[model samples]
Target: MRNAPLGALETAAALRRGEIDVRELAADSLDAARGVGAEVGAFAHVLEELTREQARTAAEGIEDARRGGTLDELGQRSPLWGVPMPIKDLTQVAGQPFEAGSMALRGNIATVTDGVAQRLLDAGTLTVGKTSTPEFGMPCYTEPATGAPARTPWDLRRTAGGSSGGAAAAVASGVVPIAHGSDGGGSVRIPAACCGIVGIKPSRGVVSPGPYSTEGMGLATDGVLSRSVRDAAVGLDLIAGPRDGDFMPRPRPPMSYLDSVGRAPGPLRIGVLLEPLAAKTDVHPAALRGVERAIELLHGLGHVTTPIPAPFTPQEWAAFMPLWSVGAASIPLEAQQEGELLELTRWLREQGQGYSGVDLAQALSGVQAIARRTGEAFSAYDVVLTPTLSGPPAFPGELQLPGGADDFGAQCAFTPWTSSWNMIGNAAMSVPLHREEIDGTELPFGIQLGGTRPGEEALLLALAAQLEELDPWPLVREPSAA
Candidate 1:
C-alpha cells in the first residue's frame, strides 16, 4: 500500500536479493548515491576515502570467512558483511566529523565511536558517511545553515523532518539501505514518516548511549530508519545492547528482535489518539485520515482499537518546554561558540541558562509525574496508536524558527504527538501504511505504534511486521539503472 523508492534496501529481503553479493550491494548503494547526497542534503560529511577502504576490507573479510567456512552466524560474525550505511551526525563515530549540524562545532571530529555506531561497525556494515541533522537536534525540522534543507524523496518541496531528517532522506533517496537515527523527541520517526519508511525507536535503555547519557532523562535514545519493518527489526538486533557501566540497561531482551518478526502478537488492545496532543493547531485532515485508516487496518488484524484522551492536560505539556530547554544547557559551548549559534538555538540556551537548578528539578519532576500518570492510564492498552506526524511532510521553511510562527508553535503544528513517547521512554515505531493527498499532491504518512513505559520492544516489532505483511510497502520503487 506504500511505496519505497531509491533507498529501500529491505534487508530482510536478502533471502532473495537476486543472489547479489553483499559487496555488490555496497558498490551499488554507493554508485546510486553518487551525486544524490548533495541533491538531497542528507550528508553532513561523506567519508569517501574511508568508505572505499572499508568496503574493500569488508569484502575481503566476507570472502575469507566464506573460504574458512566460519561465517555461520551473521551480524555476530559478519552481520553487515560489506553493507554500507550512514551514522547520524548527532552521534559520534571514531575518525569522522561530528558537527551535529551546527556551525558552532564545524571543525570537531570524533575520536571515539558511540555505542550505536560501534555496534553497526562491528556487525560488518561499513560506515560510508555521517548524515545531516539540525543544530544540536533541537528542532523537529532539518534545515541548517550548513546545507540545503533535507527534502523528502516523495517530493523535494517538503522537508524530511529533523533531527534525523538527513538520514531519512538519504535512505529514502537510495544513498543506503538504512541509517542511524536518534529520537530525543520523534526525530527518527518524524523523518521516517516524512520520507515513507520504517523508523523504530527502541525503549530508551534498550540501546545504550555511552560514553554519554542524559543521566536517564528518558527523553532520547538512538534508533534506526530503514526500508521495511523486518529491516528495522534487524537494526534493533544489531544495535540494541548495554555497554559496560551502562546505568539503565533493561534486562537483556528475552528474544532477539529479528526473531520477533512474523511472530503473532495475539489480539492487542490499542488506544488510538487522532488529535494532535498539546499543540494549538488543528491536525491536518490528511493526518486524521491516516490514523482512521490505521484504526480500520488494526481492526482487520483482529486488534481492538478505541479512542482515548492524551496522557496529560495542556498545562502539563508546558513543563515539557522547560525540560526541552534543559537540553540546550547540556551542550558545551564556549562564549564564541555560543555567539555563533542560530538565533533560536541561542534563545533556547539562554532560556535554559535562566532556569535555576530548582526550576529544572521541578520540571523534570513534573515530566516524570506526567509519564507516571500516562503509564498508569495506558497500562490498560497493549499499545497506543497515533499519526507519526500531524500532517504530510511540510515544505521547506514552514517550520523554521525565528522567521515563522513561534518556533514552539510551528513545531507543535508539524510534530504534535511524537515527543510524548520520548518523555515516557516508550518503544515506538512509525510504519508507513498509507498515503494521503496534500495540497493536491499525494504523499506518504505513517501510523505510530507505541508501547507502554518500561516498554515491550519485541511485541511492538512483531505487531509492526504483521502490519507490514497485511499492508506491504514497496522495497525499492525506482532504483536507478541496475
Candidate 2:
C-alpha cells in the first residue's frame, strides 16, 4: 500500500496527476492507523466503512471533473482534494461516534456535522476517523477513562499531550499527512511539541465554531497539525473563513495562507521570553536549550532578537482560571453522569459552579482588559518567541495522577507559555527545532512563535516556513525494530 510518505499538498498533487487514486490513499492511511495508530491509541474510532464509502465517492467525483474539463478549477477550489485527514474527537461528525474522551458520553452519536468538519469535507478531504482527546478536552494530557492513552510515538511510555494529543500522534506517526485539531489553552501546540510535529492555532474567528459553538467564550478554535509548515498552511486555507452565525468573524487575508508560506517576512523584530508566565514552575534546562538554539537560528536569519519579560501577569492568570472553570461548568452533564467525569474535570466543573453570573461577568471583563493591555505591550515586536512547553513530554499518568487542583496545576506548569496568545486572540505556532536525550530516549522540543497582532497568521507562517527550510523536521517517526 502506498502510504502518506508525502506531505498533504504533494499527496494532493499526485492525486490530481492520476499518480495516485483516492482509494489507495485511504487504504494506506487506514492501514497505518490500524498499525502505529493502534499502537499509540491515536483514535477513538476508526471509520473504516465510512472512509471506504467516501473514497469511492471522491474518486468518482475526480473522474467526472476530469472528463468535464473542470478538474483544474476543482483542484483550485479544493486544494486538498482526495487527501485523507482525521478530525479530533472533540468535533462532531454526523453519524459518527462523538465521544469526547469521557465515559459520561459513551455510546453518544452525533447527529450533525460541526462547521469545522463541514469545511474540511468541503475541501475534498475524507475523514478517516476520530482522534482521541481528554474528557471535555479539559486536561493537557490525553489519558481518557473511556479508551487507551494517546502516547507519543517517539516513546510509547510518554504522553502525546492533549486535548489534541491524538491528532499530533497520528500526523507524527504517518497515519495521515495532516489532521484536524483545536486549541484551547495550548491543546494543539502542546501535543504537537510533544510529538515533534507542526501545530498552528489560528487567531480567534479564523475558523468558525458554528451550529454549536463550544463554551461561547472564544478561547478555543480549530487548528491544523502536520509534519511541515506548508502542509499546516494548506490545511488552514481549507478550513479558515467566517460562517454565517459566527459571532466574531475576522476578514479573510488578501493572500491565502498557503501563498504566504516561504515569502520573505522582512527581518522581523523578535522578542524572546524564557520565563514561565501563567504557571509557577521553573523552565527545564532542556526547554531553555531549545529556546537558545531557536534564538541562534533567528539571529542567523537576520531577525533582531531582544530579551523580553513575560508579558502576562499573575493577576491575568488569576482572572483567566475562573473563565476556564466557567467553561468546564457549562458542559452539559446530569448529576449522575457527573460521576463519569475525570477528577480534574469534575473539580473544574465544581469550581465553575461556585461562580455567580456576576462573578463570570467580572472575570470576562478582567480577561478583556488583560488582552488589550497585553496586545499593546506586544506591539513593539512582530513576533514573540518562547519554548512551546516548560519541559519535555510527560510519561503516561505523570500529570494526571493525584488529580484535582494538582492535575490542573501540573498541566499549567507543563504548558506555561502557549495560552497567552489564546487569551489575546492572536496566532501561535509550535515548530519542532531541538531534540534532547532523556533516559536513553531522544525526544523532540518545539519552540513557539506567536504573532503580536490578531490576524497576523501569514507572518508567522512565513517565519515558520523559513525555519523549516533551514532545519527540516522528519516527516514521520523513525521505524522501531520491535
Candidate 3:
C-alpha cells in the first residue's frame, strides 16, 4: 500500500531503476482497487489480467533497457512508467469497452484507443480500468441510472461531483495516483473540487480530442485528475499534441508542460474573482473563506493579490446556455437513447431538440464573442483566480430532476461554476486549496486559474505549481480509523 501511494513520476522511477517489479506493483494496485472499489463506487470496469499483462510487458522492456544501457521506447524512461492508471469511462482505450457512462450503448466496445490513451500507454502506464461518468457526461453530479453513483470516499452519503466523478474519487482514495479526465464544461474540475484533488481543463485544442472528435463544440477538452499538480502536468505532457488530422490545433508550447512546472513564475499579479460571471447564485461563506485563505497564502508566496469585479453582464451569461444545449446535442444520439437514459441526459436532449442549426451557429458566434471579451478582461493581470464550486459538495438525490421538462432546472441546480470557462475556451483548473471544519470533513475547495486564450501552456501550469508550494492540499482523508 505504501508503494501504491507513489505518484506517477515516482512509480516510473522505481520501475526503471528495477527497485520494484512492475508485476508486483500492478498486483498491489489491483488488490487495492478491488478492496476499495466496492466501498467508493469508483470503477465501472476493472481489468485484472489485462493490467498484469501490461505491467509484465513494461517490466521486460525496462529490464531490456538496463541491459542495453539505453532508455526504454517510451522515451527517457519517464517517471510515469509502471504506474497503473485509470481512464475515465468517457474515453476510448483500444480493445476496451467505452459506454460514455450510459447503458444505451451497453454492448458497444472500442476498436482502437484514441491518441491520448495511446500516448499514456507509450509512456509505460498500465491500465487499471475505466472510471464512471454520468449519462453522456450530462450533469455535474454523477448519479447515473445504470450503476451506483460514484460516492465520495470520505462520505458515502454525498455525491462525487461529475462527470469525472469516478476519476476524481479513484485518485482521491489512492486507487491510483492519477487518472484521465475530460472537461466538456467542468467535468474534471467539478469532480476534483468535490473529491479534493487537482483537476485541469486545458484550453481548447491544447490537447487533441480527435482521431475521434473534432471538438465538443468548444465546450470540451481532455486532461486529468490527480492528487498532485505535478502528476497532472506529466500526464498532460504525455498526451498533449496534434493528431494526424485536426481542424484546429492549439498553439504549441515552447517546451514541455512538465518542464514548465519546475520553473518559478516570477512574482505574479493575481486577481481574485469571488463571484462567477454567469451564475445567479452567490458563493457560500465557507467557499469565500477558502478564497481569503488562498489570497493570504499567495501574499506569503510573494504575489500581489487584488479583488476585481468581472466585466460580464447576466444577459451575456444567459445567452451561452443554448451553446451548452448544442453540446448536449453533440453527445452521440445512439449513446443518448441507450438503455433508459438518466434524468439529466433526457432533460438536456430535450433542450437540444428545440435548437436548429442556425441557432447553434448563433450560439457558437456568441461564445466566441465572450471568449474575446474575457481575453481582454485578463489583459491587465497575470492570472485570474476563483473558487471551483460556489458551495460545498451535494448529497445524493439533492440534484436530481423530476423526470420531465424540469430536467433543465435540475441541471442548472447541479452545476453553477464550471461551464463558463468552456464557453470562453480558456484552460481552467480546480486546485484543492482548502478543506472545511465540519466533522473535520475534507470539503475540497477549488481555486480556478484561467489564462489568456492561447497562453494556456505557460500560465495554467505556472500558477498551479506556484500554488502547489504555497498551500499544499492534503488528500480527502478516508473516514475509517485505521
Instruction: Using TM-score, give the best candidate's number.
Output: 2
lDDT of 1 by residue, 344-411 (tens): 78778778888998998999998889889999989999999998887788876678756322876788
lDDT of 3: 0.76
* Overall lDDT per candidate, in order of appearance: 0.78, 0.88, 0.76
Q: Residue 340 in model 3: shift from native, Å?
A: 2.0
- Pairs that collide in candidate 1 are 4-477, 7-174, 75-79, 80-123
Reference-based TM-score of each model: 0.93, 0.97, 0.93
**Which candidate number has the best lDDT?**
2
Model 2 per-residue lDDT tens digits across residues 110-181: 999998899888777879999999898988999877788898888888899999998998988888889999
| TM-score computed on alpha carbons, candidate 3 | 0.93
The count of residue-pair clashes in candidate 3 stands at 4
Clashing pairs in 2: none
- Looking at model 1, which ten-residue stretch has the lowest summed lDDT? 8-17
What is candidate 3's lDDT per residue for 1-482, written digit by digit as tens? 12236777777777777788999888887886777765677887787877988898888878788888775554454558778778888888877878877778676788888778887777778889888888777778887655767877667777778888888888888888889988877899988888888888887788887787677576788888888888888888777888767767875687877788988885888778776665566677778887888788788878898888765765677667777666776666664363467656666667877998898888888878877887788777777778888777777665765774555454454455567788777778888887785456656667677665564755677777888887787754573321
